[model samples]
Target: MRILWTTLLMACAAACTQPANKSVPETIEPDEAHIALAETLTPADPTLAPIYDRSCRACHALDGLGAPLTGHAAAWAPRLEERGMEGLLGSIHAGRGAMPSMGYCADCTDDNFRALIEFMSTEGQS
Candidate 1:
């Protein structure tokens, strides 16, 4: 029946539409020291540094973006523990929350992602 088809189409359309306001996770307020430290930190690897600067730094280094700050082991600890390297890589590939797919690094290989994760998760990196 025409009415039945219309109802099905309407339901499908409604289901496909995304809500205007998406609920975001609570973000921590970063202190000046944390901001300064995050800004200064970079991956030790020369190849990875550029990739990090271009892709990950913008969100990961700052707080209030729902991303863990660089050099903040506590923030990253739970994530690392819950999702191991492979799981974390899956998040990056799938794009979690505000982060874009491949973490905005289309050219990055698995090894590159692993290195970047290690650098960001570690506490004492210059």
Candidate 2:
């Protein structure tokens, strides 16, 4: 009886010490490698270039910041879904989380902001 109890305790300990299974998601989002690659890309649009360099590039194009890395469609898609274009604009206007109002584009107009968003959100695709 004591041996049976001891064996059960050992089994429980082993199970508890096992590493967790990180099951894959049904929809595979972009992996870290993609995200890392995206971090180095900027908008291709010439008009939006300065705007991005001045404001969006610091956070969106870089890692270690809460802002979503640019060019990663998987990351940006959900955000777009949750907060439509209007919501994104409002967030940009009022700032969201680590982002500041107007995303630090002190001179950018709403139209410019929209273009910048479009450019950043659609960086990698053809």
Candidate 3:
């Protein structure tokens, strides 16, 4: 009985510590082309464009920074669905993760944040 219990424990430990499959990458990095394109993406609305450029673009447009890449619907979908608009705005207001408070847009109103969120969360934006 003691031998059987020891064997089971050893088996469980070995199984738990086995390295993850190398065939599946832990993180898929975006290529340079995608990064370049992300850099140029902006909100279509002129009013929102500057704000996005100044405040949101730096982190949101880049990959591997923990911020969701702008215009990536799949990345933004779970956040939007889970938090809804108001909760997202609250995150911006209070700052979440690497994002600064109010997303670094000091003068932006709730409406501005709403529009910016809409633009960033959408796909196929120019």
Candidate 4:
């Protein structure tokens, strides 16, 4: 039975080792409205402010200086124009050249991440 299991596992591994598919087309780009929505989605985390204050305010700064608060519309505008929302989030998730992963907010969820970016991007809008 063990021999049969091992052989079956090896065969499965071999089959799974196939080369990556190269024929899939690129994803369709998001339209202006979709992009706007991605950049403006409001989340429902009431703890976001306290979370930011406790975990994020140090480096990012409340006034958009140190790390540039997420709410600052101008600072993020050029980045959004150049990289798009996903690009910016990837930087936060994987850490940019300077910014650390998850921007150091360990408790943040995907929603928190989106909310942070959206809220910060609108910093100067008001």
Candidate 5:
């Protein structure tokens, strides 16, 4: 009876410890083309101005300085260069610092997050 109990415990532990399948869920891959769009920004992109105005500007500041200014390239440069585009996108989507997820931009899509990060980094001294 003890041996049977031990076997049952081991089986339960194995089941609990097992790693989920690698492709069990969907994965998001940042699109480079989306980042490129930020480089040649225009006021016409209604989403950009509004997103910044309504949501991000409060914390990140009007000039991307709300939490801290975007003027300091050194601050954002390393994160951008080291983490790369995908990493930045994930951070934005996931939130960081005093920033809440989505930066309060409820309708933010992958393209939108990529665009915002690119916009913030593009003006960087880097």
Candidate 6:
């Protein structure tokens, strides 16, 4: 009876410790074309430019930085599908992967974050 109880406990512990399903999609590789194009992706709204330049431009413009490059639709599509705008906002607020919390924008409002997302997600459309 004691051995049976120990075995049951071990089984339960193993089940509880199993890793959750990893559903991440394959990231699209950034080509030279995409990287150069990312450089040209800037927020059309003048008000959002400073915020983007200050917070998002550095990492998002470069490839292999673990950031979805600004204006790379292929890179951003799966993320958008999985996370939606709200989830993206939450990730930004909490910082996920290589991104820092609030994307390092100390003074940005929610509206500003939305606008930046829109600009980056759309401007790269081919």
lDDT of 6: 0.74
| lDDT-sorted candidate list, best first | 1, 6, 3, 2, 4, 5
TM-scores across all candidates?
0.74, 0.68, 0.72, 0.54, 0.54, 0.77
What lDDT score is found at residue 71 in candidate 6?
Answer: 83
Q: Which lDDT tens digits does candidate 3 get at residues 1-126? A: 534643553454346443333332222344555567677798879999999999999898988898877766555655654567898999999999888899889999999999998888776586
Candidate 6 lDDT, 1-126, residue by residue in tens: 544643553454346443332343436566777789998777777888888888899999888888988887666655666677887888899999888898989899998988888778763642
Q: How many backbone clashes does candidate 6 have?
A: 0
Best by TM-score: 6
Query: Which of the predicted structures, 1 or 3, would earn the higher TM-score when compared with the native?
Result: 1
The per-prediction CA RMSD against the true structure, in angstroms, equals 14.9, 14.3, 13.1, 16.6, 17.1, 13.5
- Candidate 4 lDDT over 1-126, as tens digits, reads 544643553454346444332321212222333344433433345667676666665655433233544444444544554566777788888987556888888768877777777766664331
- Reference-based TM-score, model 5: 0.54
lDDT of 1 by residue, 63-115 (tens): 67888888865556456545668889999999999999998899999999999
User: Residue 26 error for model 5, in Å?
Assistant: 30
What's the lDDT for residue 58 in model 1? 92
Model 4, residue 77: distance off in Å is 0.2
- lDDT per residue (tens digit) for residues 46-86 in model 5: 76877766766565433322343333323344455445678
Please, what is the whole-model Cα lDDT of each candidate in the order they appear?
0.75, 0.65, 0.73, 0.54, 0.52, 0.74
Determine the backbone clash count of candidate 1: 0
The local lDDT score (0 to 100) that residue 85 gets in candidate 5 is 79
